[model samples]
Target: MSQLITEVQPDVEIYIQSIYQTVVQRNPHEVEFHQAVSEFLESMAPVIKKHPEYQKYAILERIVEPERLISFRVPWVDDQGKVQVNRGFRVQFNSTLGPYKGGLRFHKSVNASIIKFLGFEQTFKNALTGQPIGGGKGGSDFDPKGKSDLEIMRFCQSFMTELYKYMGSDVDVPAGDIGVGGREIGFLFGQYKRIRSGNEPGVLTGKGIGYGGSLGRTEATGYGCIYFLQEMLASQGLELAGRQTVVSGSGNVSIFAIQKAQELGAHVVACSDSSGYIFDPNGIQLETVKQIKLVEAGRISDYTLHHPEASYYEGSTNIWNVDCEIALPCATQNELNEVAARQLIDNGVIAIAEGANMPTTLEAVHILLANNILFAPGKAANAGGVAVSALEMAQNSMRLSWSFDEVDGRLKKIMQHIYQDSIEAAEDYGFEGNLVAGSNIAGFKKVAEAMIAQGIV
Candidate 1:
């Protein structure tokens, strides 16, 4: 992780390293969190040199730690009438800009390390959106797959019964992530309302449209990534039109990214799920993918059943092997490693936009940058989801909703600004055209400035 930091003044690099060491000591065995902190601090070396006051105020040290970490036991009864328990967590990382805002993920991989990493990343991601939202993240290790609807509802109820006490319209707003989706959000929202005996839709986002969700929230993250990609490509005098694309993960993010990329004239040739990936040389059939993933909640393998022309691979990561000019990793964190990055680079990948948080490893990121490939970090590229979530919060406060076009327009503009802001921050700090450093610096400066203004708390 220390090797990730480069091109820094000696004193600044030492300071950054020291802060990262303390972070690791304080949170041992939290590999994901350590990776996130190290990657972020790598960008801070220049910032520390440019802004000496940040060091005087200990911004790096303070920013790495969370304001609060809440863990509780979620107890529920399964369909077999047996009692079950799972650990739930909420890491309120930072609220300097505004209230805590992030998402709740439900998966077997949920742990303090993962949550902290996501929350830490979310803090910067939210800051880049130009929206009044801070950073936080929560979830349980309860796997929703293969669970009955009733069982899932019971779990959500139990989770909400304990979580609602810390949530409110202006306190913290949680949306959907990995395992939690519209159905799960509805259950959590219902339990929150039932417990408080009040109607406050603003307390939660990614809700059902009937219950106050925004029209374009589902499509925001994917569309926003493409928008950011558009700006990044435009910066290099390139365009997305007719470019060969490969988007990993067939979930909401990947699906919408493919759809939007196609709309903008990119030909998405490959997409995947946890089980496997499909390479459709004729361009992916979005409707069939939507049916398997969204409608039936089925596997990506079923896609071949609908269209015999497409080729399905057994492993998910192999999707990168397909030659493409644009590669968007929309799957889990670290899904694309140095090897996959080399594959992309050797195969002539011109651009990569992370639709998932930290999907590419630190080494992979360096390799891509070293190759002069246009790369957009997830914090900046994937801010679309939370950007639209903030818009949903605004709509809820106003008791009104905007049309899809309206919300989408706002989302597009926000992404444009984020791209510009990142580039400006990078250039200002002598890391010109480095979106990774640019995004990290821009977001850290925003939150750090706010934290300083608010004083040591």
Candidate 2:
């Protein structure tokens, strides 16, 4: 019940407490946003000591608030000639680094709180990529899961009708998120082009390759998650090879994480979706998963249809019960809670890397850290997607595209740098191996310095 940030040392605790209090008071009942701000701030007591000027300039206070919050209505007609209306949102949290950039999530759970929380996390996630992009996020409560193509097109058109005005190549750039994949991105980009009357492919990332999309964009996040994990393991004189891994979510991130982990010799035996999870002791077949989830657009349970030897469970959280050496929560926010954390730890999970934003709850993270599990926060582990998105922007701006190998090599280097930076930042602050705190501090210092240099906005 008591405030978490105020539990630190007396001097630095006051600053963190003050900023979080302002966040909670200004945005009441936004527990997700508060949780995100708290996660970043609770690790920042060492940062405030290193950069006393952060508070002098109110950096934390200003950074926690959004630069702009745009909420709009999207109305469209369904296949049955029925009219539907949905609320849309775009929260440009901060632009101290560059133009506003993040994904546009389309899920039934979307709301101001979720958007704000995601945008706040994106701030540092973007920063960690070492790219010249800021943090922002947008979405609608419209679930595209069961919608027809025409219906989805109409909804995207209506959503972009108002969203296009505020976006541009060098301005705010929105990409794809949950339920907003290549199909949705294509629809949105087509509508943005129709309304704007030009070929501004730079306005969005995660686009199809035919339309200026960078190679490896789709696999970046999942691949990057493993790359960071690889680096983390190497730091401990270990490797992903021969490790049994359990990955949650059958989406882009999870699928590719399974792919890369397998390529590196890690046996990924399980992956899940909204319906439930499929555990394949023989190892998850990447192509089979791709066909079922991506091509067929079916639940992960269908994975069993391909390989009858695999097992399918009915509950999403039950995936945590499977014993494995590695656990990757590539699903939505707050999915892996304290109970799941304990389950994974007890089951001998030596490492947990997040491929989704805030997938691990704060309590879960504490449990993992307390048990000495190597934990990779979403910001550092899952930055490959945005890093490649930034690379896509670079290619588009230059009117050139790189080969798949070239793009993948660049992504590998960026992820390695991020891992090294977090390690260095943590070691410099006397908290070696505390990557969560180190990543937050490393990203915060960069943004705070830039904010101070630019003067108050």
Best model per lDDT: 1
Compare the candidates by TM-score and give the number of the best one. Answer: 1
Model 1 lDDT per residue over 126-150, tens place:
9999999999999999999999999
lDDT of 1 at 452: 92
The lDDT per prediction is 0.94, 0.92
Off by over 4 Å in 1: 1-7
* Weakest lDDT window of 10 consecutive positions for candidate 2: 1-10
TM-score per candidate, in order? Answer: 0.99, 0.98
**Error at 365, model 2, angstroms:** 0.5
Which tens-of-lDDT digit does each residue in 263-357 have in candidate 2?
Answer: 99999999999879998989999899999889999888988888999999999878999999999999999989999999988899999999999
